[model samples]
Target: MTEPRFHGPDFAALEASDPEIAGIVLDELDRQRGGLQLIASENLTSPAGLAAQGSVLTNKYAEGYPGARYYGGCEVVDRAETIAIERAKALFGADHVNVQPHSGASANLAVYAAFAQPGDSVLAMSLPHGGHLTHGATVNFSGRWFTAVPYHVRKDTELIDYDEVRELALVHRPRIIVAGATAYSRELDFAAFRAIADEVGAILWVDAAHFIGLVAGKAIPSPVPYADVVSATTHKVLRGPRGGMLMCRAEHARAVDKAVFPFGQGGPMMHTIAAKAVAFGEAQTESYARYAAQVVANARTLSTSLVDAGMRAVSGGTDTHLILFDLQHLRIDGRTAEARCAAAGITLNKNAIPFDPAPPAVASGIRVGSAAVTTQGFDAEDMNAVGSLVARAVRAEAGTADGDRELAAVKDEVTTLVARKPAYPVI
Candidate 1:
């Protein structure tokens, strides 16, 4: 076969080759800049980071660790990957770092591969009660392949019950215990988890996908000292390319690396790794620390405003970038609230609050996040206004003239608010 030819890195070239895909890309960018993005799992990657993701490194096929790659001509990609790993280690104070897995779920899969055998008992938070699917929801691979034992929060406090965790650990004696959440708003007691894991002789794995950025910015406590291994996604509040990473103790470093490559995945995405490195460097700055602090402050203010407007915060309020709001008292459901917010130019997701009566599809609560908005330069006062807008939209009745007017007004205000700080101002 003849040597293949590749095009240069330019939007003009893409438009020239395939304007349809280019138009879709531009439209997505427009959509992002046009409205409020409140999804807890999303954030805008910086222009520099985006450039790295779109770099020529995408052509490389580095199938193994940096220096021991299976493919030839991996020298440049090796440098990028090494930089990513070192930067990540510094950012999280980790003993070893693997910048390979394609997503957070992928990283979790690797974690299982590294530490546990199929059918080994694993303990984690329950999915409907703020845990991630990989933490052992029945439908996920983790739950299907392993015996899953779950723990839940207290009904009154809506916080993780350490006593229950200890009881479960003593009974099940799982091979691994995961400590993390996707929808939880309060800080996790890593020390508590560590103690429980030690008692049970279980490996402590912390999925820091959602809050690792906060940890990197020093906005909250780090799980590095407590956890045997930690999994994270470079996106979310980390504001990098969409990919996964693993950090583990030096003793488990070899196992983690082998698990990510050959066992869990092949050829790493060198370009995304480069982008993660760029984001890691950015996260080390003072401005990013300030940004992380503002993210938490904004979420707290927004949660208080929602409570003032008659909605209830799941854990009273947030100490991080995310908040879970219960709409039960308003006699509304999460699905309806999600639709209303979307119609009013705001975007968020329906989520199940702890002990929610409604099913997952029509959840009793909605999950909101401040990372994207805070990155767009929203302060606490701006968050308060956003909270009012969200409340007005969600509380408005549908199929009524009065409700239509209310939603329209909120939509107008939302348009005005987002205009003040565009998601991608340079674009």
Candidate 2:
């Protein structure tokens, strides 16, 4: 609360002798807490999840899966992990679930290790066109270890072309087909993907990391029905800790479990697993469903507002929690917009629009989402203003020297708005 005190009493005393480094860390935390977090891949967890994450469970070493441990004092950790896995399986209707992958990418790696060998062909969505890095970007380990073939969306529509995906799958005949993405703005046709995987006898791995909460709330069709393997992060829309989980059919449970344990990783972080269970329990409520629905509504509202302001929103609008705005078309690069917004205390990420001409450092797009803002109780009206502020700033950034002054005013207004809506309330 107090700028996330980087040093405790003792450490503070030690650093008090020379407060420069400690002062810098404190300033950084103040900056983070002061800014509005609009990054789609991020979320603040519930108090219960936070409690579990910082609990005594961190003391134990649970080397193997539940019911099998390499050390003592893991009985409680086993229960925690079991509850997490069971709740997740029930939530997604999966035959098996593993709550130990350190991250979503690791979960994907475990699936690959379970189902295929090194250098095996794997099909995934293209990075620039809305695929995750783990789904075989050139710089990622997936592309290095496996033959990663990527498919993209239609250029004009900026939506996934099922026909193109099928054509690529058929031509590639991959060992595994990965569905889902990091920055796409439309609902995925999991059944269509299932059919393509079926035709090639390839396993379907769905990375529901970005939309697990919406899927759990039934706001979007759950990918579990069509996917052979599912990997997701505990945070994002899931509103849990920063970790990943994996689920699969019972037939592949042992293989997947082994791959995650001795093969992919060892000694699970029990505290994170405990946090996952807590968040999963929270995801089962009726209120969460309504929250999920509002997420979509807010996205649509925000996207519509931006488009009306003369910004091009890819695919016309969104069916999920994110909206990708092509800033290049507005004569503003994403990098400049991101800096300008950050100076105004708005914290969103710059991204590449599908098949963008710009480089990663200076992207052609800016992705805005409403999850964190919605958590702060901002509704459609707030999104409209937020959208307008964003659009104006980006446009002004192109040629005006007064963008900095205007952004500073926006930052003061945002801080005043945030002061009225507290993230945590007295329960």
Could you give candidate 1's per-residue lDDT for residues 1-427 as a string of tens digits?
9775965488999999999999999999878888899999999999999999999989998898888988899998899988998888999999999999999999999999999999999999999999999988889999899999999989999999899999999999999999999999999999999999999899999999999999999999999999999999999999999999999999999999999889989999999999999999999999999999989889899999889988999979999999999999899999999998888889999999999999999999999999999999999889989999999999888668998889888989988898999999996
Error of 1 at 60 (Å): 0.6
lDDT per residue (tens digit) for residues 1-427 in model 2:
4686443234466477868887885676465457677898887788788778977788899999777788888888889998998898878888999999999888888988999988999999999888988888879889898999988899879888889889988898999998899999789999999999999999999989999889988899998878888998988988899999988888889999999989989888999999999988888889888888888888899899889999889888899999998876677888988888877788888999888999989999999887777766778887888787777666655335686678777888777666666465432
Instruction: List the candidate 2 regions with Cα displacement exceeding 4 Å.
Output: 1-29, 398-401, 425-427
- Point to the candidate with the largest TM-score: 1
Worst ten in a row by lDDT for model 1: 2-11
Clashing pairs in 2: none
TM-score of each candidate?
A: 0.97, 0.92
